[model samples]
Target: MSLDGHTAVPPESSIPPMPGFPPRAGIPTQHAAPPGGTPGFDVTGWVSAKRHRTPPAIFSLGPEPRPSDPKTLADDAIPGWKLILRAALNFLVALEIFMWLTGGALVWALGFVWPALIKAAGQEEFWATTLLNLLYVPVALILVFVFGRMGRWKAVWRRYGSPAWSRLRGVAVPTAGPVRGPVEPVDVWGPLRVVADPGTLALLDAETAQGLVGDVDHQRLLGALERVRQEPERLAALLGAVREHGAVACAHPSGARDLPGRSLAHDLLSRQLRLGAAENVPKNPAGYRGADIALDPLLLGTSLLAVGPAGSGKTTRLTRPVAEALCLQALTGSAVVVVVGAADADLGPAAWYDVVVAPGDPQAGYGLDLFGGAAHADEAAARLADALLPDELALRTESARLALQQIVGPFESGYGRLPGVRELVLLLRGEEQAWAGLLAAVRGSGMLDRHQHELAQRERMHGLADDPGTLLADRLALLDRPVFAGCFNPSAGDRAPLPLFALRALDHPLRVRIALPDHSHPEAARILARLAVGQFLHAAASRADRSLFAGLVVDDASAAVDTHAVRGLQRLRAANAGAVLGLRTLVDLPESLRAPLFGAVGGRMAFPGLAPWDGKLFEEAWGTVWVDERDVTRSLDTSGGVVRRSFRGMRALLEGERAQTESVTTRKVERRRWSASDLAQVLPRGHAVVSLTSVDGTQVPPLLVRLP
Candidate 1:
């Protein structure tokens, strides 16, 4: 079977018989009839022939035993002979008691009077009896001590005499003989062993192992050797297993239908390996031969790189996997999906997604129009009121006085009529008298004309002002709706106001995705990405238990992230937040961003592209084993349509050769296509590869789904 165009090698047919072992003589070889058995020939001679069997054994009798002399028996007494004598004496005492009981008359009399005797004796007699009982206690204790010592001696003798016990103790003591000289204490410690051996250890110690373990290095080396010896096969098997499983595909687009089956095999292998399963060796399923793509779920736990030239289905693949995640989130009620693009028009409304806020054209000033209108009106109203109120009174004293009366009357009617207006009139009359007296000194000065000119200008300003009622109406209108402010030119001087309108509007948990095309711009992308991240953080902080966001998707994420920002996302991952970031090519990313971004991402998907750098980046990001330079060169040489030869003392020569044809080659190049079945098995469209690192630490393979 073949997977991803790689053929599987078949199993060996027959294992060769072991060498150097000859067939035993007289061992008859039996063969079955070919297909059908013919009439059997009589084989009475073969049946009657002596079979190879061992002869039966016959029992033999030995010489009779000799009688032991009494003197010899006494000298070589059995162990615990003294204890046996004591037991015999105790038994005789028990027999005496039984004999007395059987005699009947005396025993019956003792039983009848014993309790009455104690009662008759009274308190003083009882005390004397207790004293006598205490005397007997010491004697009984002495006897118990003597017996315990005897039992210990008997146990020691029994243990030494038992052959099985001697084997366990690793000593063979003679059962019957004059005692040998005192036994030396056995050294119970087993043979000392070292893995690298003493010579190798000394060499290593002289070289690399100098600082490894310091003074106790020898002990450490021994311990390590013990561990290695205990499980040498396990370590070897682990290394061999991962090597056989090979590279795992983390993610690949569903549109590349040719890749999923191969990708799935890789994914399965990776998962099995991660679980420490020895049986996860790669095997091509019979039906899946010729698979074009292979995926490994373990690879998804790392980062993924999707690479292709423009219009080569890179974005299509990236988005497809993301869409599938959204669908899954919807199904599980785990997340809400939001699609943010360069413009609102870029994302057509779909049922699975919600457009919280759409990106607008920065050049059109729509943001300013929406947010700045009310501010402008308020400023103008205040300016007009400041200029007109005082001047209107001076220019038309009578009209102004009448208007003031109307204003004051309304307040008076609302409250009680106030004496303040009357006092004000009296003060103005007194001021007039004082002004008349100073008129001669002020007559030739320009101050009076300047006041008159200012008064006249103010009168015109007041004439242009809207009624106070109208001013309130306009302010009320401006305050009615929320406003969205677009990006402002930060370079504009202090005169330019900060974007308070947008900031205030964002206070509510509204969605705002900023697309920063010029990531290279001084701080544009950083600012936007920061703002987006801030919103998430703010929402998370404000909510009681997190889970405040619908969802945030960052497309063309390369522009929005830097090293520091990626680190921030890594921290956010602990908060159960979901994010999807799309990149054009993983190799093109700045190292600062690449390291942290890859470290943070829980899943990845890749699309096919023609770039050696892409393969290198993928290998690094996914932790794929690097192909040996020699092996790569050999493969490439075979790949080229030329045969090279070298003769002794002659220059190498090349001969033209045709390339081997493939099933799906176009113009002598392989064509990549993903089918519907492949998509069904993995990620869907608009979502290239759907790799997910589940909460339990399992990496789910990239699901290929077609985007609607």
Candidate 2:
């Protein structure tokens, strides 16, 4: 419950259960311990409380923890005078009780009760003296016990007087455990039973129920329930279809849960992946202050570029969560996710992906398609050139593209296929035997006559001293080493290489993970990363079917953000696709491409320990917002009395400042959303400053967020 007198409803509990399907006996339910403890604890009750259970919702982290809002010092404050007064009052009350029980009893006994006792007894003086003395000691002792520091009277007096200790203590009370119920398994089928026919629900068994609960998306389940409620007749057939096939019948290609383990938290019904919580700062937008910082493909489709240094929580916090969300979305048949990272990077469990392209791993199960499955020679040439050309040689990108096209076009035309990495390198070197064989083959096929003009241009460029082919060949040779033998070969005869363009052809969700050869071939690894990114951008843009949300997650995009890749990133939102590019620093990219890369992506994240220079890019990209500025000034009190003025003059003469003067002024001013220094120095560990833009163009200003 909130302070507004209305209950703060949980998202899942907001949906009204129609009817039917009471919780089964073995269905798990969690319970939370009641708040606070007595002076003496209930050891048995506390220990017996359920400590752990299954998660309540499939997408949530067990339950929301208690908000640790700091308590105000004023709430528990007691004035020094009140403290003294309360102690004095308790002493007085205890003395009064002691006096009444001892002295007052003596008087009462003498006046009434003792008169009758004296008449009945013989020695009145002795009896009265002994009884009165005994009463004094016993009464004083009893009163002392009752009014002691840890006694009931002390607590009662404190509650009754100026320093009410119990009420003050209540302000900072701690709970024994979370104030929630047992973790009930997410009731996926309960809603279905209510809307659908009883016989339809009867078709579901324990296996199917568990499958639906774990694998099927909650939103898809709700949509199905809504459809069945509207047309009751459809329930039977729908249930019957899935009963034999299980929950995967409605899921994407592979209906089973892909990841062996989950680390980050999620809430899939709203299609939002929890990243962190926005900080409560005045500069933050009204609705976003202290809110859950989350994003879906809609926000990501605009593309997200995260800049941070190593160990800045970029991979563990941002990249992993986004990849996991997309993978989960893939299970629902709504998205295609491709994660590219170093071999050792923990993006997710390998089992989560259908294809794992480990280039140099001897035990690798799959290989990469260098051409991105491009059928056209020109398309493959452009993608390859973007990948191989270094940022220094970016000026010759066009020449390199055309240069590769000249070789790749003729080879494919003559040999009926594109050249592999080793073969392409040999051809790019302009070896006599390689060119002569190709020329003869093209002539035999009559390609030489049809493409004579293109071949003539290729020969003329090949003879130049500064030909782009030499630069491309040097870069291409990096991948043709013995370490990468049979890596880029499509016809390796053992495993079929997965292509980037495969995303376009899939109706169901597809997950692909490409692990680069980072250790043995560091430079080659960067080239591979860049190649995969460039190919992904082209393949995503050219997709004939854009129904599935296409997402690319690059754990370390050190060499991927070229001018062409940046331009391609800008157009992804319209294609219903997105890319998450993580970089250790902006220096990993060309200085010229930095600003353009920031501008291309709609979502920008600056993680902790960011360099001041890198933060400036984010600062400039985020721009400024209107804020209230305060100014304070102080001046001498010249209009006061003679004594006050003399004291002020003396103080001013001694200290070189006026003692009694003050002023404050406030006005609206424009300030940077996050200053470079603040982003560099003030950002906390496991936190980042992010600005988001949704697919529909809903903009969220840069705000500090504490990563979950």
Candidate 3:
């Protein structure tokens, strides 16, 4: 990159641009900076290949077994001496305010009465007043100590003090605007802070920390200091590191979304973090205001749900950024990103990921074994059947599941292996001589009675186009399509290896894309999606040990959600996995899954076009709290002349009646924290209400965010 941050790349680049983020103007196709150019420990050993660095602490070379128990770090606490000093300082301030008020009142009273008293006392009175004034200085000094500071003033102030004054509008007063320069993402001195575990902090390699430092010349150093106004954490680090290394160090932190596109790759590839601020808003520190648009991964037992209209920026703004971040994570050995419906182009570039499995792209040559993934043959069969099940066959889910198990059971016994799509289709159609062998094996194995009923039912349905041929053709159309012709056709010749369900892949840091044909064959796309999602969930749970952070990014989730997804929704986090699911609204989900799915995700962003029922789901999932607000109203009216109105009022009073002349009213009102209607249609374009969950399971108030 040049000092101005424009990237360099070759013209005939194979790397594709992200969906919404086509290569920006002047952003040449390019490769990322070398691993040594970034601040992170090497994680090359963790991945299948030495693609990148930045390994997890426990994942590095160590005989120490990974600890299963969670660790907690104690919060920073104010020392007793500091607390005492704070109290003393507060007391002195109160004493000063009291003395000023008392002095002002006494001066005003004396000025009023001095002339009358002086006249009454004459010359002797004047002398006496002069003597009294001479004594005032000593008296006031003693009173200042006795009544203001060392007396019951503290108690008195406490009894009448309005703590709300600081919070009241027009009293404490807000800043004219956001600070002109940078502010902390979160304050070091803020009351609420999550103490990061020592292990987490130790992940930072001090030797390579300099890579995180950027353009630290005198001018840049001054510029960075000018921007870092209140981040004590960063300030201390820079100062300490500079002292330790005998070199001044500083990093440019962008205040807005003005960072060059390549800068994103720097943060991601650095391995210190998976996300960086794509765009930023100015800070308002007094209140928890402004946007924290950091691209945080939904892993570590958390997930993200972004709901918005079809054309809304949920994909461009939310999903794309997250997918990009996960791709970086996958490179750094921190995450395994399994994205469905998106190819190298849909996300960022193929080089960003270690693997790209495009099922429909014939050139990609990635095939999926229809039944080899699950720990049990039963589950594998069930998931494949569910994916192949027709949308209209709602009542036949069980029957389809049974038919799959029967076919799978006989074939596995006969062939001693799970069948690919082609082989399974041939066997189910009863055209292959292998079917006779499979049936004989099932009967010999004494499973024939259990499978006969379902097999008969399937045969009866096979005669109909809606059940058998449609199911076959729906997927077969994708297989037959010009784009995916030879890739999935095992019967045609040789087959590429299908690695979708490999358990070892879970712990392996790699980016895999399950690209589907969504536009041409929607049902076929849905079928592939359901199967992929289910397998990811089941494979995640089957991991022998918790190691890598796995993530699934589904951009068109409305079509993919199924029974397995619902079952895996809440459990994925525990399995050391996360998913970013996108859809129009909760209305698209089944009623039973709606609430659970919403509750399972740790992050939710509701953009415009939220329906009423969807709003209710968000409302209930986010829950509600009673907030008190003053409801003020005013009225203006023409009334009778002053005397006439007064006479009528007096007469009514004498007659024990009421007169109406009220114009203003103020009353305290309680309402829901965020009403259903607030999300349904009230939010403006580019604005959304979000609910974020902390690692400790704390629910934050629905945050109002302006999408960047």
Candidate 4:
């Protein structure tokens, strides 16, 4: 099976050659709009000859099957069609001899028209030929001009013009002019050769045809070649017969004959979250625009989702470019980034960031403050409780919440700040009080109610005194790892302290990296990521000024659920912050969280590797799309159970009344403007069906964007 999941047909999968070409069914076509066009792909042998496959030899076709010796047709009793036709041909041969002699008598038989034949041959004069050429030139011009007005010109040429003729002849038509223009530049990825039949060519507008004609990057070059509902017939009619590079296109077009790549850095709009200009920039189907990474400064408040399986190139194509662009922004002092990714993931231009926290990096000494910013004791306790607990620990939420409030209140009452994670861990363990001030503050400031409250829960919690702490301790173990030694508790280790909320106050632009080693301790990484995000949200919520732009990025979000996920996903907009959350599959999210989490993000990218259920999410996300449907019926005539279709086909039929098996078939067929299953499992690599909310709140349809 190829990338599109069809083993039978290749590109030009849909509108197969109007009735007389090779069979191609259930193939994929590039119909772009986007939010992007589906990038070109061929996992099967249809686009090109497969090296491992040897096509069967054609032994029974053409006129070569004619001939039989008729000595019983072939020297013996084994008879054939020749045995029956030989006698019939004998009489025809006699009649042919009589007519052969009559051919020379054509001049005598039509003496009256002899002069007319000679006149056409130019036997009259050179003057006569010259006169006709001059007169006919003017007459032919007039005839062409008159016919051009009727639409007959367009309709007729659609069937017989360059595009159509090229298809009919089974060859690609050269697009360059006969006379040379300036030398054309070549693209680095090399040239792409596409062979599309005329019907497919008919559906393409000139600009699009030009993009397909030129050699560009796979993302930009092939993305512009997508076909949609308006040209369903033409899309299916086209076939990509020749493929030598990463891209493929139409074999013929009626419009712009040459396609050229655009310059991204200089020609693009010079503002927020912009990447490269779109391929064939002006998107058709009107309102479905392209380019502009859809990462608006105002809208980052809503968020983004980039998903695909490992090796699907989400990092290279989608993540990398966006990261580099954001890095550039950070360098300009406009935004702050808190990016958490796999340890080895490359974030461009390291100098742009002020902080880099790599787990297991002993020398860096970085860990979030854990409870850095809280308006009061209750809020801090609530946030900590949520972050430290998981859904599996349902019984612990309220108890842990009450216990955390007790722990933080005493620490804050004494030290004037919330306790660090390491301190919280020790206090939960009931260790001897190392800080005499905590004991002193608790006893002296105790109003009668405070003392009674602390004692009341002690007996009620006695039986489960260590349960909640132990469970949370396991998840927080990474904080004490050698890499984060000095970072977790300022007093516990001799190294410099690194804090999560420290950057929230920075007036200048800053880049922050939180490295999670997915390749090694994925679970630990996930838990840490969740804690950091929850802290960031708390920090964002308390800001006196929400003017500063901030982004929190989590790659592989499906791995774990942090405390702030629900509010952070849906309500971060008020904090003037946006998030980019990456997930491999939606199934990883709990059922209760899935719906709201999806609804919260204003922009989405559904890449390959999603299951049908996942694809259905996109369908719902994209909502309904109106598509053109064609019902095709195919019939197979079986003569004596041997299927055949020809003038003499009746000869093979069983003569008597008989029972026979039925032979015929027919059938029926979203946001990628395809079925959900196709978008989920069959979407080619490095591509996504994107639905983004424009600044105006216009809900654009999901568009195919070949990732760059």
Best by TM-score: 2
Residue-wise C-alpha lDDT for candidate 1, range 272-294, written one tens digit per residue: 11111111111111121111222
Top candidate on lDDT is: 2
| Model 1: how far residue 58 lies from native, Å | 73
Error of 2 at 81 (Å): 22
Candidate 2 has an lDDT of 0.66
Ranked by lDDT from best down, the candidates are 2, 3, 4, 1
> What is the C-alpha local distance difference test score of candidate 3?
0.51
Q: lDDT for every model?
A: 0.31, 0.66, 0.51, 0.48
Report the Cα lDDT for residue 676, model 4. Answer: 79
lDDT of 4 by residue, 1-708 (tens): 122111212333321221111233322222221111222211111112211101111011101111222221222232334333432343243335334433444333434655554365356577654553454455445544543322233333433364466556543323210111222333322222233443433323332334442312232223223332145544333333222111233211111111112112210012233322222111112222223233445545667787667776666655655554454444323445677777787644333344566666654534555554556777767766776676666457777777777667776666666676666666665555643444666666664356457634532453474656556555556565654565554543345665433433322234567777676766667666666777667666667655456777776677544435766666666666777777887777777777777787877877777778877777777665444444544444445433534422432221111223454443332223545787876676666766565333545445565555
* TM-score: the better of candidates 2 and 4: 2
lDDT of 4: 0.48
Worst 10 residues of 2 by lDDT: 1-10
| Model 4 worst lDDT window (10 residues) | 53-62
Q: What is the lDDT of residue 84 in candidate 1?
A: 49
RMSD per prediction, one decimal? 42.6, 14.2, 16.3, 21.1
Tens-place lDDT per residue, model 3, 1-708, is 121122211112222111111122211122333222223322121111112211121111111221121110000123434434444554565567557745565445555767564354345676756754664677566755643432234433332343344224222211111111222232211111122223322212233233332211222323333333366665444444334332122221111111123233223322322221211111111122322323344333467788887876777666666666666454333557777764432555554444456666656634554543477778878877777764555456776677677667665665566665566666556554755666777678777777777656655665465465335434534444445544442442444543333423565544566777676666667777787887787787777655566788888788678666767767776777778888887767767677777766887778788877777877777664543343444343336798877766644433223454454554555455556788877777776776655444654456565655
Model 4 clash number: 18
Q: Higher-lDDT candidate among 2 and 3? A: 2
